[model samples]
Target: MKRKLLVTAFLLGALLLAAYPMFSVAASSGDVGGLIAESDINPRAARTVESYSLESSHPYSNNFDYTWTITEPGATQIRVHFTKIDVENNYDYVYVYDYAGSQLHKLTGLYSSGGWTAWSYGESIKVRLDTDYSVTDWGFAIDQIEYEGGGGGGGSETNVLTDGVTSSSSLAATGDTEMWTIEVEADALSMHSVLTCGSADFDLYGRLGAEPTTSTYDWRGYTSGGEDVTFDNPGAGTWYI
Candidate 1:
């Protein structure tokens, strides 16, 4: 009886651990929506403000009026999906700003004709409305701007990686290597690079100067073709140019 009880407890714990990952993945994948504030809108005549209807196939089908605002900019990403299609063919716009009202990015494009379309901004400081259009009897939807980070660690500007040298042909080749260049910059943090091949297996290396020097880092594993690869920052360090 004692042995049976122990086995059951062990099985339950394993099941719980497996269940956690499944739940997390499901939660991360889904649709999100919300309102926009009046202040974030750019004062340009080219800007068209419309109401967002998450349920409508055409969220901005007609002239709808409303005002909304976002308190935090760096933490929001505005998105809009269209539901209706007409000869007018207006496009949905998404904008972002920092806490100080600095423009971050803007995306303007037409939504899917009859399918669900989405746009997103990772971290923003605040957002505001661009129009006073009231939306009634429309099928448009607006999602609450959610924040998506580039992934773990600090922003790309601060982290740098220097993988040691292997060979010129070792980097991933879509077809040509001349199109590639090593780039780096600073924002809130630094970032580094790790290369992966898309067609052939290759080794990746990094260094600290315009040319390969005495110091370098090699990838622990080789990436295969058609594999999505990521070059993560191995903390803050000097990288080859």
Candidate 2:
């Protein structure tokens, strides 16, 4: 009887050990880390193709500074694309900002004699600018912006437009609602926003095909007159807008 009981106990211990990995895998599978998936927008074939042009005295000024609040917090990855403008000494770039308006990612190096260029998604924070002596037109026809994973399966994402696109009459300056779209593949999602300059603002909206069920948030920033937005989801998804 003693030997039988000992054997039963040993068998139970082995079974638990075997079950642990499966449980761990299930947990790990649920946690794929934060990744910004593929993008729908494709770069223009010709860099010389000028699809759109900024209005005179647009981009707000020769020097532009703008900010985009990340409605979804804890985003680890991001993808941004833009249409390159044609001009002499023209430089364009994007910057990633934290909740406190702190610099995070600076993505630069896109110069346009003419054409469209896109920036790939990665983990970085700060402002990206053009490196040239003569000040040519510096701005891109921004097509789309995407965010991926971050801390605790959720991350904060935000962007600041500065020293580049500065005119109030520009497409991005008019608070153009038709510029871009946001998508989220997670189970639940949330968002918030704040506009500093009345003339220039970051207008965010969802697509028509599919949408997530969650609360949208909006808050005003301490400075710069912009709002801080935050969005949260219950679980994960293949994509989030």
Candidate 3:
């Protein structure tokens, strides 16, 4: 039972960003020349669950200035998603920092729901809360913190999936799906994806604006053998796979 799934995408000139799920499984024997080293990149374990969470002190605290850093040994990238935010409009703030302590994002006021920090490079990121002695509110809660372990972090401004790149991953168990993204520009020739799964069966799904699932998807490669999918004159924007 081979545990590896190799996916190769060819975009005439579009940029590709491959985001895989993490698994504790051993490295696959299959070739993955295009993927970052195993030590630096850990894809999500499963699409169904978000990884970790970070929350400000309940109701936060006045005159508070503290930082929390999340680190994964070899993570190449770290992303934070805020599910809720309720801090003083301008008197208080929640700041996000990269491994080197440089400011990355700031969350303030009540309308900060569903905000995501720009992707941070390196294995660690710092979240700091600075409050004045005036007022404080419910603060914020980060529902998920995603990190891709291992590699020489930083470089590309965006996680573009390079053209004609081959990336591979080993799914440790059943029902594991790796997620990836590609930014397709207008009037491009075409975008193609080739999925090669060893003996194990896997399904490929794609959507334009959001993550795809077995039930809802814009394109699917359902055959038992390796699958191929392509889009011609595809719309401009992000395409999830």
Q: Which candidate number maximizes TM-score?
A: 3
**Tens-place lDDT digits, model 2, residues 131-219:** 34435443334434444444332222222211122212223223222222122223234333223344333333322222222243121
Q: Write the per-residue lDDT of candidate 3 for residues 28-120, one digit (tens) a residue.
A: 233222122122223543111134445555666688775655544466777665665667987898788887778886767664334456667
State residue 43's C-alpha deviation in candidate 1, in Å.
38
Task: Give candidate 2 misplaced runs (Cα > 4 Å).
Answer: 1-60, 63-71, 85-138, 149-241
Best by lDDT: 3
**TM-score for all predictions?**
0.20, 0.27, 0.42
Candidate 1: segments with Cα more than 4 A from true spot = 1-67, 72-94, 113-140, 144-241
Q: Per TM-score, what order, best first?
A: 3, 2, 1
Candidate 2's displacement at residue 151, Å, is: 14
**Total backbone collisions for each predicted model:** 60, 52, 18
Question: How high is the lDDT of residue 201 in model 3?
Answer: 78
Give all candidates' CA lDDT scores. Answer: 0.27, 0.29, 0.61
Q: Supply candidate 3's per-residue lDDT for 53.
A: 47
Global Cα RMSD, each model: 18.8, 24.3, 17.8
